[model samples]
Target: MTSNFQAKIEGLQYDALQIRRNVWRALHGAGSGHMGGSSSAADLLAALYFHYLRQRPDEPEWPGRDRFVLSKGHANAALGAALARAGFIDDSVLDQFYAYQSSFGMHPDIKMPGVEMSTGGLGHGLSVGLGMALGARMQNLDFRTCVMLGDGELQEGSNWEGAMAAAHLRLSNLTAILDYNKVQQSGRVGEMLALEPMADKWLSFGWAVREIDGHDMGAIVEALDALPFAPDKPSMIIAHTVKGKGVGFAEDSYLWHNNLVTDEVYERALNELGAPE
Candidate 1:
């Protein structure tokens, strides 16, 4: 990559680091929240909101803005952090997570300024994103739709239904990104229910597929930049990630999936993550 491109990647890396920090911060405020999936998705979320998506934070309802659906809605903490950082929402809302009547709950809320769809239930986001893509096509709009999914969430058959429909319809403007963090809430996803031959499954469904290191900023950006990997098919990116990425004690552990967050634990996590520059 050229030096300018490398600098851009470095800037996104810094944003991703800040996003991870903010995820912990938001969880700490709530006293407890879904940390594992949220932390795992930070890098890709950063790339999408900061670099790829053509969004207008100041004018969030702009009709032409690309749409993003967080199918793994349990990662709303990371999404909230990214939205806050991107100026789509106020930073102070981070502290209101899960608070009484707070919109920043465990799931994405459509009422939120930048959220494309209200989602948290597994296997629903892809379908909703597919609808958005079809709407764009039908309306002759150039907007694109992207949906983020959890590896474990694939257990729901609805995703496959949506996958088939998108491919059958040749919705190239739609992209599905799977945060394949092997481990889920209870245990390793492979142990719970293996999704081996995952890429083949998407290919079998007639979508173009790519796999990348979920935590690598450059790889995340590159994969996103090369969107709609095929002209006549939807795109799928299987991003391999660790459940609790940045913090040493939390990394790869299912127990951290939705565990309590105390003051000391929060401080320790921040210390390990260090200050984002």
Candidate 2:
């Protein structure tokens, strides 16, 4: 049953590699930008942008399109790559990342064509997504709202507030994806403040929960497909991921949290990620 999903996951990895490359490529263009969170989100972002999110690349403001919130706005590089890959923006736009007067920055901005919310505040996306879902319900629109959250951000108590409220509203239109990469800026989440029993906490809060290897494309897609796992609750997909998922030098560590780019490091990162056949 899961084999087919695995095949899709393999494809998603390829897509993710492309995204990881683009992330560095974009940062290289900017000459400076976020990479740790962005790299960690590459695979999932590829799956969402290329396979799941019902979006209109040619129509960024399509009224019927599903919405995605990059709550961990530091991962905007991956989001930007996905958006470019999905055709919402010119691929070259990434080349201008962080350029003066450029829309791309360390965080996401709603002014950008493909960005739904301007988020960088650790624990805000889920709450905003709840509002978007609730609005969809009130408007009688079938569009769903998905929020991509950071594990470090979960330390904020306000996320629990949104979790509580989403379930209270029974917002099946909503889905919160926790990018559980273990490490945050300073160190490992476990060492900082453990978020163990993660799935249980969501379930206890009235959210229908699913756990998946965040870097596995198939698991991600299936988890997304399994949305609204309960008719009476919001859904939470907890993605266990590596801090810097693709690059060997960067994975699972806090040192790369906000790194400076150099020509040698850039080449090494690209080589580590490897070129696709």
| Clashes found in each candidate (C-alpha, N, C closer than 3 A) | 0, 1
**Which lDDT tens digits does candidate 2 get at residues 17-92?**
9999999998877776678889888878988887789999889999899999999999988898888888888888
- Lowest lDDT sum, 10 consecutive residues, model 2, at 1-10
Candidate 2: pairs in clash: 9-218
TM-score, cand. 1? 0.99
The deviation in Å at residue 260 for candidate 2 is 0.7
Top TM-score model: 1
Runs with alpha carbons beyond 4 Å of true place in candidate 1: none
Model 2's TM-score against the true structure: 0.96
**TM-score per candidate, in order?**
0.99, 0.96
